[model samples]
Target: MTDSRIAAESWETLRARHSAKWRRYPADVIPMHVAEMDYPVAAPIRAALGELVASSDMGYLGPMPEIAPAFTAFAESRWGWTPDTSNARLAPDVGVATVEFLRAHNVSRVIVTSPVYAGFWHWLEELGIDIVDVPLTSDFRLDISGIEREFANGVGHLLLCNPHNPLGRVFGRDELLALAEAADRHNAVVIADEIHAPLTYPGSDFVPYLSLGPAAERTGVLVTSTSKSWNLAGLKAAFILGHGDRGTELLKPLPEAMHWRSSILGAFSMSVAYRDGVEWLDSTLDTLAVARDHLASELKRLLPSAHLEMVPEAGYLAWVDVSGLNLGDRPWDRILEEARVSVVPGTELGPQYTQHIRINFATSPELITRALTQIAAL
Candidate 1:
């Protein structure tokens, strides 16, 4: 039997967690919202963080020469793709990297595929950039023709979510290559958010935008972090990878403080995660796969009217359509009030998905069962 790396504590014990998922709701609420996992930090990452704290090594963050190489090894081993280290830079997180890269290129109007990671809206709004919404196809893949129309008309940037959040759709190489070609033809930059790439399941192919083709290498900027995969969001470390003159120039305006903003503990822990945490990661994946199927079965058995739009291709979040539940305007709000289960509101992704709710299933099967049962009973 494979050892499971992810296991959830009881509700009483989990209530003590200092994270937002636990603290945001009252004691009666079961949090199934936040992307962070309920699993304990990996032994390697915990050990790295512990050594830093013990030796009093905490100080202003400096260039860690190890991050690029460690990430290179992890990427190659896991994805069979090797990144160019010279083209990589560290930022506090993926949000910061996206904002700075757009600012560097003086991007005023950007296109986003909806529904998207909610944070993408905040990043664009803060920079005073106009948003052009290109909603995904009904099947939840990119609307390529829509993207081309937006790009040809004046949109200069596109924010892409690969192994997309909520939907968990791992985009294919052909689709990504077509996007890269469209961007290159229109001289538009594609900022690919690939943080969830590492979490993809066994058979799903996660094709990195940068590895798509020459057009992709020229037109895409890849930003990713260890936060999502290793459950280390609080650590605050991410990588910005670019290639050639276009890639390098787009990255040049990142402020010097970008590096300083990352925690020293985060930097080292990230390196350790990439270099030595593979065994733990594999174990975690196995657990998550079983949890994913378990949640689907539970939901199907309990709520026959509810629809899981896509059996997730990756990650623990499940985007469920509750349209059949007969819950009004804010179905998620009703779920929380009646069922006492906290889920991410569908409207956060976009106004069109008001009947949908996102559930974080990265917990013990018992918690998933409890949450689904409560919803079904309501």
Candidate 2:
């Protein structure tokens, strides 16, 4: 049996680190805010980084032909869908890749489903693109009809979050196919940010947008990385995957510096992670599953009024409706002040979600218990 506690890093060790998750709040505050996992780095990635540093091989990023094959292999093995590797391109991170993909396609306006990743709003704002929000259904599934309406109304692009953040809803193949068909009908483009696909829990199927066949290949562009899955965001490397003639044409306008700006260490480490990090990933998933269950049970026992609605099917983020707690319009502020437990305010994800809060359960069951206990006491 896999040791479910294997991924839990000691609080003492984690607290001493300089990452933003630890540093943003004071010593007294327990931060469950950031998306970063509290698990130790994967062995393959660590070894690769150590080897690179030991040889003093750090230099400008160059042709890393290994990235494409590694990603394709992982995709094939994990999802049974092999992407075309010839059109793969590198970028500093997912944000940069997304921004550049939008810019290259001359997309002036885009549709986003909320409550979505907070970064999506920041990215579009930076590009001066108009945002058309088609919020998900109350059940946290895609508003396919709403999305189709936006595309029909002349919104030519969409920024999608697969294995959605906060909600942790891994969209199904039927939903994605419906979306792909809608985009094809409207001559629209879909840029799928599949960063969380690898973290999807068992029983929830994560459908890759580009894997939906001809319509998807024509209308979809994929951007993903080892950063989210392997907890390597600070290392700064991600890739853009294009497919078919339309996909290939859309990527042609991306600047050459997009690849050059990527860190060599990040790129090489990402390759190593894709090629050799499966065992560690599987172990971490087991640990995460244990943590996720702990959060659900603790919340139900300690804070019954806090409605978890649906347990997350992927990743460690849990969206809770704290309206029942009567924490007011700004519940997160009250929680921060009283409980000293920091979590993401739902308003940051979408304005209508003021009564909600996003909790990161990527830490140990003990930390989850500690944080929930603090919040429940309020």
Candidate 3:
């Protein structure tokens, strides 16, 4: 593969590409792959979460210690939209929080924009809810008219993904407002997954679903966690934000303990991350920004036949147009066997995305180089 400017750059960029190489490698084989990064934890996060774990303090924790503040602080500091911390509640994960919210709302049939995280269906099935699939257009965005058709048939809930995964398309405010209007029309509660909001590209704006306007009070939105930005996925802590009476009413179906799974260290980490993580997050995002550029350049250099798709301003994950590659049944498996790289397949997300691949570019420079080299050879 052609060389790029990974060196003579930021530590985040250098570390990301290098770490992946070492992590999935034999002594000699490099790994410019995987979503996991090679960089060490930010000092504040390392210090805060480390202090508790070092003390062997693992136990059940209470609700997120000002998770709303942690998140809203990021929002206000970055997006200028102030999310009320008071509405924040805790859940083990975003997917869990979503289904739990739906359960409470007595929603048996939920509608989701297709080719999402893919696991949304797993969660829906686990919760025994039927799904309404609204596939995105060829452009990887909502087929708004199709959604309305589904709404006409009836939808009890709507799941929204801001800065949607794989494709990294951050919905515009007007787009979100239109979605909210549809859910409202169907009498469906809107459950949004804004987990990747923090990593939003530099210029793209993230529009919160519930924060839409007066009509949003009746809409149920669940914003949670800093896992994507801070690289804290294993921490298993996330918060759900709801509005007014509508928020409270959605919880009538579940027992109180369903909301009690928030772990102590996770909550502590969320607080510490929010309170002292501004610089680290900025730096980490800076690293991700580098990864994005690296991936873009490498894609052009190596896989010009592939559709790089629309990579919104933010995010390290890429939605590649592997359709031109034409690998069938299991493109991810094919890439792994041919290239020895593990990537998330689009098939899991939906049939429309079968030839697509979602690559996590959060690794080290060497790893990125090597991963691209392998793909170029393929």
Candidate 4:
């Protein structure tokens, strides 16, 4: 097996790779804003894609029995929960699956926990739904009482981001159970985006929303993928999982196109990933655990004034409080222009978080060091 713990390619080689993370910025800039990792694809996944291409087997997607069982096996092994494979369906990606799920239910408004994934806002607005922001509490956990308040005001859908983006706090099991109770009492539906669940660090616990209990099973739907977990976003495929009979029935009316829209290559790779990508994933997680610590320590050493909102509990992104640096309204701009390090500006996350910047730290320790050093120099 290839060593997933090390980034084999140098900056010059990586810059020429075919991905937005490389092409979006100039060569001199360290592009650490996007979620794509710096590691190579898993050997099992690479071999699967290669064989498909070599045989000219690239065709439209069709039913593959392995999809559901593969995910079920992974979920059971990783999180100790097993989803009913019969409750799963395919979509082009998480975004499409989310919007389509909302549309199918005639949902016109959603309760969103903000300072969340920016794409949640985009997807809701594109569906012509009103978004009610229940921003994360100051500590970056779900504001359950605030969410309950919003639910009381007539919103039927809650768009949840588990193992949240940017801040990277993996929502705890008790919090999720309380949320499930609230949703059940208010008759609200939860559409959880669990795409980042697979990448959660060793000590963090990522509780699947649908696995909470009977109340949660009735009120929840999960949209997840190998895209974020396996760096297959460009390939375009994801799954929508309903908890039980009620939840499954709710998802049954989705347009047939949702299934057809998924890429054949993506579906094949996703199955391969869940089944055979565990070794690679374990190695990547080991590497990221080190990288995560390295980034945090480097930030303290180089930029003591800048505060990390929370050390990420999962994934590679770090949400930092750059307000202490006093670098104008948008600190990311200064960092990009002066430090030549591209990071996501806080404003894009939400109006309440304009003083922050989300940094992707899933790279070599050397690059993490350089990026922090540059920011400090600014």
Candidate 5:
């Protein structure tokens, strides 16, 4: 879990969701939406890219041996987990890795918690899997018993997000271990998308499920990436670390003709980001903490009638209750157009949460302040 009081910005995300209005706003008018950031990419990352560009080395690419240990170091430093490099395989993106894993396993049923990331299902449609949506308990933790029931007929997979998207809820060791236990019972794989792991509140703990003692061996936990915390989604590189030879099996069975796999640039970027960008990431986390708090406090003051989830842990997503605003079935759009701010709607995440608007708070302080004022007026 990230410290809520430290940083204040969800920039890249803000820009993406609010781009249309951002284009229309005056030079100073802030469009508080989207997940893209206003901050320049980290200096070290920029320098590394510059060095690569100077060499004019962009061309056809292949695997690099430097990625695993670098990421391993990051895991050890941040989460106290030592990833078994042998169990890891590279994937282009977390979402792709997830849906592909589901399909590869011949899975026809899925389980997920809502209000979740909007793109969670982008990879599942073609497979025609039975989608099982479960609302979180009032406390926002996944209901283990409920999940077990959903798996009564056998849930082939569970898409689990830590430092979860939209809600920003960071589960503790016990919380994640419970899910691992359930997955073990059903012999289902738990695809853990920990892309947001690196940005937790300072001093807060993040536990990778596999490290939760012995139950993980049969759990088939797959950690997607550390890119989100580093803001490298565009890099499209994630890793699958599976124990007991599962990762080897998955790679061997990798769709024979699938060539749009990990990219050279993506691998290079991840290696550099994980190995040398620690300080830069620390500062980014600080920025997000401040921005999320401001966004939360502002929403409370402006939309007092709305029920905002008090985020206990997680990323920069501010899930605000917008159902009371009288925008039936389209509250996210209603707020987007009316408030001139774009946000990931809860409806996209799941049907149970139609009234919530997930705001990306990782942006410039000024834009967040402006977006809040607009929402207040709306």
Candidate 6:
């Protein structure tokens, strides 16, 4: 209820904004679809960008030596692990970093756990890489045996999402170690998209893939950004970190332009965010925690049959199974039409998830209540 660092703007104010989340829907619809947050940017990141523009330093990105050290410090403080900053390389975003890394490694086929981030499918399809979908377990945990089976079948690449997007399940260290061992045994590469790692809740442990020791270092590649955690996607910058020499060798095939193509503003903003934005980040997490719980409670009270199987362990997304609502196969579409609240169709995340929907609950509890109330009325 404190509005100091994490307050979302008024509906009128958010409606005036030009972002896709606001613009994609008409005034009649409440958009609970996009992953972007409604909160203001952290003060440190805003000040840094303001200073850059005031100084007219709008030139192309140059040496961002600060990035490595800032990221190292943040990683150490948050996760008790220090990455090999020497192998940290910049890209325009996580999508570009993932695509470029897979392309550089000549990866023709990759294993993806579903229902996962929709972008994972798009990124792989763009490269014409064969996708092997190994769905998560019934409880939405990693299907390790299924993944191992795929690896044994000669799938040499795995695209992982930790603090996973739609479901918000943070992969534990034990699970990651098992995965690392499997990848090592099969000489497979694991590219982890850990963009949401920093948003993990207090009780859940988010293990960075590269922090799993020798096997992970040998077979793991990490792609992350300040975009998801700090809400800086528009700034357009992300980094890939490798474990050591082997990690470095794995990334060697990426083109030099990958570094320069990044926005200078994005690069420095990320550095500032990592180094100085922890206070704001923590406050925002607290706010999101409340919002997440509010969404769950409202769902239970207003729509008792809707299933939020797991109270999300990280991020603002809530994946609900609405099959019990009996709204038919494409419930998201029906909800949009009847409730006038737009949410992500679960089928987009994976083919088999037709009766589910993903809601963005990073706003006020009032807004969450309103959205759910409207759905309940339906």
- The numbered model that scores best in lDDT is 6
Q: Which residue pairs does candidate 1 place in steric collision?
A: none
**Tens-digit lDDT track for model 2 on 190-250?**
9999999999888888889989999999899999999988999888999998797776798
Q: Which parts of model 6 have CA positions greater than 4 angstroms off? A: 1-5
Error of 3 at 350 (Å): 0.8
Task: Flag regions of model 2 displaced more than 4 Å.
Answer: 1-5
Clashes of each: 0, 0, 15, 0, 33, 0
Q: Give the TM-score of candidate 1.
A: 0.97
Judged by lDDT against the true structure, how good is candidate 3? 0.70
Ranking by lDDT: 6, 2, 4, 1, 5, 3
Q: Could you tell me how far off, in angstroms, the CA of residue 224 lies in candidate 4 after the best superposition?
A: 0.2
What global local distance difference test value does model 5 have?
Answer: 0.71
Compared with the true structure, model 4 gives a TM-score of 0.97
On residues 1-378, what C-alpha lDDT tens digit does candidate 6 reach at each position?
224458888999999988889989889899999888989899989999999999999899999998889999999999999898787889999999999998988889999999899999999999999999999998777888999999999999999999898999998888899999999999999999999999998898889999999999999999999998999988989999887789779988998999899999999999999999888888999999999999999999999999997899999998998988999877888899989999999988888888889999999999999999999887
Q: In model 1, which runs have C-alpha deviations exceeding 4 angstroms? A: none
Cα error, residue 23 of model 1, in Å, equals 0.7
Evaluate all candidate structures by whole-model CA lDDT and list the values in order.
0.87, 0.90, 0.70, 0.88, 0.71, 0.92
Clashes of 3: 15
Which consecutive 10 residues in model 4 have the weakest lDDT in total? 1-10
Cα displacement (Å) at residue 277, model 1: 0.9
lDDT digits (tens) for residues 230-293 of candidate 1 = 9999889888988877677777787877888888888888899899888888788898998999
Which candidate do you rate higher for lDDT, 2 or 5?
2
